[model samples]
Target: MEWKPLPVGIDDFEKIVTGDYFYVDKTLFIKELLDMKGEVNLFTRPRRFGKTLNMSMLRYFFEENPENVSRIFQGLNIMDAGEKYLDHMGKYPVIMISLKSMKQPSYELAFEMLKKALKGEFQRHWQLVSDSGRLTDADQKRYLRLRDLEGTEADYADALKFLSECLCRCTGRKTVILIDEYDVPLENAYFSGFYDRMTDTIRSLFESALKTNESLEFAVVTGCLRISRESIFTGLNNLKIMSVTSQACGEYFGFTPEEVRRMLDFYGLTEDYETVRQWYEGYQFGNAEVYNPWSVINYVDSCRLNKNSLPKPYWSNASSNNIVRTLVEKADFSVKQEIEDLIEGKTIIKPIHEDITHEDMDSTQDNLWNFLFFTGYLKKIQEHQEEETIYMEMAIPNREVRYIYKNTVLRWFEKKVEQKELSPLYESILCGDTEKMGKILSENLMETISFYDYQESYYRGFLAGMLKNIGNYIVLSNRESGNGRPDILLKYPSVRGKAVILEIKVSKTYQGLEAKCQEALRQIEEQKYEEALRQEGYSQILKYGVAFYRKECMVKK
Candidate 1:
């Protein structure tokens, strides 16, 4: 029997339904949301945790679509709940906007993208102005300017609430507003140096539509990070925030354990469930444990095409995991220790703040931690309160996220090494200045956070990367030499200039560093590691043995 194709990368509700894709039922999100009856609701989730698709599903379920709105939601769980919920099916004139495309390099380009996207939304509901016998000539002209893309940026600022009013007047019903990735503009602006202007623009849009608009029945917004009310949401007090810290909508955004099992069973691949759980299922949202729905679906699709495909870090690769790198780079000594602890399958305690603005993200270490926790790099495993502060025990969410941390740490370390002046170290090594070499190596080690558990191979790679751009020298790692493999070899590409050999050893303790360095040097000589360099006609040679213990290193020549 053929299975329904998994909806990989398709977030449109109608497309998934009509295309016969296998969709995880989350329509009950509608029932729960309506029951709560929030004036304005905001959901903060990590990227690709089904926020866009859920927003799409919500938009389709509530919009005033006459043709096929109810048809797509048919036979789902929401339909079985009876008439009270079904009465809301296509009840309002819905306005949907995605700020994702507003991520531009400058405020001008970003606002243009916003205007273009808003123009499309206006065009979607042009019938409100054309068919609304209640619309005045002024309203029609206003709508026409937006529809025709002739409005100034200020005119488009409060477009949603304005559109909602016209929609209500035309249909004699209030409008339900849906905004997807609402923080995209804010995030972009903060990084692009135009944050205040973008903030005022979005603040106007949101306050008009959400805080002050009487025509709005309700609004739902989704984003990865929650900008504080003090920033973009200033003076908004009627908002209901449902984040990963909330138990209300925990199971809606991601596939639960039961859902994952059923999805695997549907594809006749239940045997892969354990592997799937290990890679994607450790995320804790509220009180429920759920898998990353995006990665799980993509992984199962891979298994369908090939039975032996290995699980990759699908979710991390989907969006920018730049937060991980930022955290790694900005970490001080204590912060570095915390990162090392988290990467080693351990946990660290930090006060959790859900609402963090992008502009002040790195102002304090705690703010950065809060950013990582909310953005899905770290998961809150335990929570406790102390005198007006809430602290959480956080860890890397799962192997996939851990893989992201490890990979980000390695890349940041490499880039850090590449940017520093390596000429001094090159000269020190050439002059057999073991004192300067040891000091430089140890200082560099003290600056980086190691997640490889201080492995010798890590140090070897670290040294190799540091030597990668030495003037006229080519760096090789673990390559076959005279009688055995050498850990690192720095040689002139043309072989007539000079060469250096390094053998790395990891000491069990600081006291053993000298002994380990001697052992490494003995092995280098015994293994004839310099024969390959000498055979290439280099008369001058430099050899050193390096031993590392945590952040301290000893170099012997």
Candidate 2:
């Protein structure tokens, strides 16, 4: 069978349906929404999990387009629902806007981007202005200002509510409002030093559009994180939130196991099912195990073109992942242990705050964990409530996300080493100043994370990574040298005639740290670990032993 081109980045429902693109049928979502309609609904899921595409699907299904209703959704699951459901299709004036593009580096640019997006939405309904006879004079001026992209800050603040009222007046029907990535500007502002300004603007905008708007039939919003009600929603009594932990619409945003199996079978790639599952199929949405749709689709597309192609970390490649890195970098002792446990396939229980704002993230560690959980880096395995709080056991969602954590941490440490003034460390090593070396190493270790019991390989990796930029030396790790394998061997090939051998050990207590350092040096002497380097024409050789206990370290020469 010939395979249709994969809709890799296409988020438009009309394009996916009308073009030759493969689409997973999520039309039943419409029936579900109508059956359990809320005045205002908010759905929070991670990026690339079909949020945009699903919103687009909702727009195409309910927007006022009677001519193409049947043609667009001819054989979908929603059609099987009785006439009561199908009759509501394409019947309301719908307004859709995505704030994903509002992630600018500064507040001014971000606010402008928001204005530009609202302008486009207003222009979509330009008929309200062209046929001014339908609208009153006041609304006509408002529509013309917005349509011409000349609206002021106050004008754009109430843009959505104004658009809804005008559409209702002209068409004699209430309007359905759909906002995608609604928290994007808030996230950007939090990182760009403009959180307060952006929050005030967005809060006012949402208040006017969603709160007590008589023109609104219903509203649906999608975002990666659910901003706190007090922060943005602000006393909207009819608001309903369905997050990753919610059982309401969990299965709609991701691909179920049955869906993946059928998709692989359709493409004649069923043999690769286990490989795909191991990489992308551990996300637990409520009671269902769902796969990452972006990675799965990209994996299938790559395999079709090249059978031997391995599944790449496509999601990680797509994101800079600064948020995860920031959390990892600021990890205290307990947070570091939790991260290690997560990497070791163990779960840690953390209190979850479903309604968290970007500002709250920096103030509490639990909020950071909550952010990670909701953003798809971590998945909840078990949940229990005590008094008014909910605690969840979280772990890395899948092999793909675990790979992301490992690589991101390593890159962050490597970058840290590269940016530091390491000439002092090099000079100390060259001069055989073991005390200074130990002090510098200890200070550096204090700035990094350690996994307590998991210390030997961890310390060795840290040493190797920090020493990777030795000016003119070649560093080899765990290579067989003399009687046994030394931890690291730095060989200078120039006429400087210098070489260094390092052996690392870990202790359980601070008192034993010094003894462990001495023992390491004795091992270097007894095992003749430097014999190979001396035999390779190095006149002066430096042998150092390093011992670590948590963040403290001792060095001896």
Candidate 3:
């Protein structure tokens, strides 16, 4: 079989089709949009799920380019919908802009990026000014200011509206607007401590272009989250949102199961279907079981070159994934328990608020869960409605996301151990305050990620890592002391004053935790784990038997 170049990271529809890249047929998305005839459509899907590519496809199809439309989409799926659908193609003036590049460290820089992107769009449609004679002197000046990125804040806010009016006047037709990654600047601003400023700017921009603009025929906006309408959209009553939970346009974003099978078969990777399914499949978008398009393409590309290569977590490496880490670090006891349950192949029911803003993210546990669910960290297994509320039973979508959670937990714990003030824990242990020690240990355990299969080795490693800051003591882990190997030993050899020994046990159930703690203590006594420390001239010894059940731990001294 001849190898076709994969369209990895190439978001331009014209380039993908003309370059002969392996393009998945999502052209039917256009037909559906026309059939639904929404005044303004908002699609929220996880990043790298072909949102950009689909937006570009829409641009090429409807951007009033008759010559390129036939060449680009001649053999694609939407061409089969007959002339009624094809007649609408390339009929409207289109404005395409992507906010993906607006990810800057500060509001000022991000706003500048936004201006640059808008400037590019103006330049793309420069023919509206040069060829058409409809613009007055004032409109022409405003167009030049926007095209040159020399516009004021007000000008930039209303730039899209102005551009749409110009296009309508120039072409004698209303305009269709396509905005990709529309919430990126808002997300960046939230993380950079300038959310209000960015929100005001974006709200004004969208309010003019989408809400109040008369020249807009229709608009399609795509982003990772459906930001609250009140915050950014204000009173856009014509807005229709299609989130991950929405059945509309579900099959357009991610690759469906059948699509993945056909692609694998085309690549002579039919035998690796199960492996691919386990790693990249299982995301439920409405009724469609979808796979990550980015991961699947990369997996197939690598497998075609080298058959022995293993499937890595390709999607995890695409972005920083700091949102999930932040959510985990800020999780309360119940939230942490839910995360543990999800990691352990269990399901959790969460009330989902689809209209969440960046400001509402850390305000409540449910908002965080909703953010996770929309961002593809979690997937819906089932959903139900009560009164006016919708609740979803969510879990880790696939092995790749599960691996991300596991690694994120371990990395986050390691960082905490480095930055955490261990003096309180150390002092509690040294003063023989079992209550304080148990509280501190249990708090740390709650913060760390835990799974159902709480092995003794995992606990031993965790205990040893947490006790690394014991002052003036050498911490040894899993070393032979007397009759057997203890979990961890803190030896104050030079001072010869006091030492500490820990025996770790993992209980299957919370009810058995106390018995397991006592069993661990009995093992410490029977094995004489402190014999080596006693022989080193330590006059005092502190022993703790710690039993763990998931994230909860019990310590007996």
For model 1, the run of ten residues with the poorest summed lDDT = 478-487
Candidate 1 lDDT (Cα, whole model)?
0.87
What's model 1's lDDT at 49? 90
Q: Model 2, poorest ten-residue lDDT window?
A: 446-455
Q: Which regions of candidate 1 deviate over 4 angstroms?
A: 1-3, 479-483
Candidate 1's TM-score:
0.95
RMSD of 2: 3.4
**Each model's lDDT:** 0.87, 0.86, 0.87
- Stretches off by above 4 angstroms in model 2 are 418-428, 431-447, 450-458, 469-487, 503-536, 543-557
Clashing pairs in 3: none
- Residue-wise lDDT of candidate 2 within 292-372, one digit each (tens)? 999999999997778778988888986547678878888887887778788878999988888788888879888898999
Candidate 3 accuracy as TM-score: 0.86
For residue 494, what is the lDDT in candidate 3? 75
What stretches of model 3 exceed 4 Å from their correct place? 423-443, 470-557
